[model samples]
Target: MDAPERHPRIVVGVDGSDASIAALHAAGSLAGPLGATVEAWACWDVPPGYGLYLVVGIEGFEYAARQSLEQALADAFGPELPAFVHPRVVRGKASEQLIEGSRNASLLIVGRRGHGSLVLGSVSSACVSHAHCPVLVVHAPEEAAHRKKGSHARKSDDGQ
Candidate 1:
């Protein structure tokens, strides 16, 4: 008898940014073809200046982070997120959390740029260098459109 196939994990980093939203959709699109489960991780760090305030404010911080992750999903996948995708909010650095998650995941996906930068974000750079699994950095819409148009031009030149 054949062994049952194991469901693979596709972990994505979300931060309520356009890039992250794109990554979420890219993960969902890939999971459908690969028969994998999508795990959305949102990380938040308390400001260093808040010492004792950090303890008292932890709950509120976590709540906001969780809500942001939920909203990103809602924005990406409409009112209800797909059943195969699971959302998680954790307290930690975004890069560290995502790298840890990559340990057991089949694929790790992130956006080329998150909420922080006009250029590539630090988390994406770290993931590319350190994730245990294969990493896919989804580009912003403008970049994707440019890439698509370039590829189309190349294909047309072949006269097929």
Candidate 2:
């Protein structure tokens, strides 16, 4: 007979950023308590101009992106991990893919910004706006912590 179904499933978008790493950690912690499995998704899209001219085209880009996603998961999860976790990489608009993936998920997590971002990124904004499930926006730690650490470092450097 089949085994019993798992509890809540979480979907997290990982783009290999600090915020995304934090989100993944948060998701894993939450999953541990809830007996849930995490579906780590990384989305990519071909660049509009140069990408369109490539001989390998969008499919090749997507394949490479999937490999990158696997590498990111390996970096995050490391070896000798349990079997409950899953990772997927899809090629499409990040927001749309995440929203679709989270339809059956209990929660969705994503970083505030990813590569090629100068400000609050668009994907996080879109997921918060559109995800069917509860959304978690993992931001960097409080500025006060950084300030305290910086002050401590400066004081030590001055030897005072």
Q: Against the true structure, what is each candidate's TM-score?
A: 0.82, 0.75
Model 2, 1-160: lDDT tens digits are 9998858999989877667767777887888888899988888887777754477556776777777666667666776444667888877878899999988999999877633543457888888888899998887555337658999999999997
Best by TM-score: 1
lDDT tens per residue, model 1, 1-160: 9998778999999988888899998998999999999999999888678898765767877888899999999989999779999999888989999999999999999998744444567899899899999999988788779769999999999985
Instruction: Provide the lowest-lDDT 10-residue window in model 2.
Output: 112-121
Q: Give me the runs in candidate 1 sitting further than 4 Å from their true place.
A: 1-4, 114-119, 143-160
Weakest 10 consecutive residues of candidate 1 by summed lDDT: 112-121
Candidate 2 Cα misplacement greater than 4 A, ranges: 1-6, 114-119, 140-160
User: TM-score of predicted model 1?
Assistant: 0.82
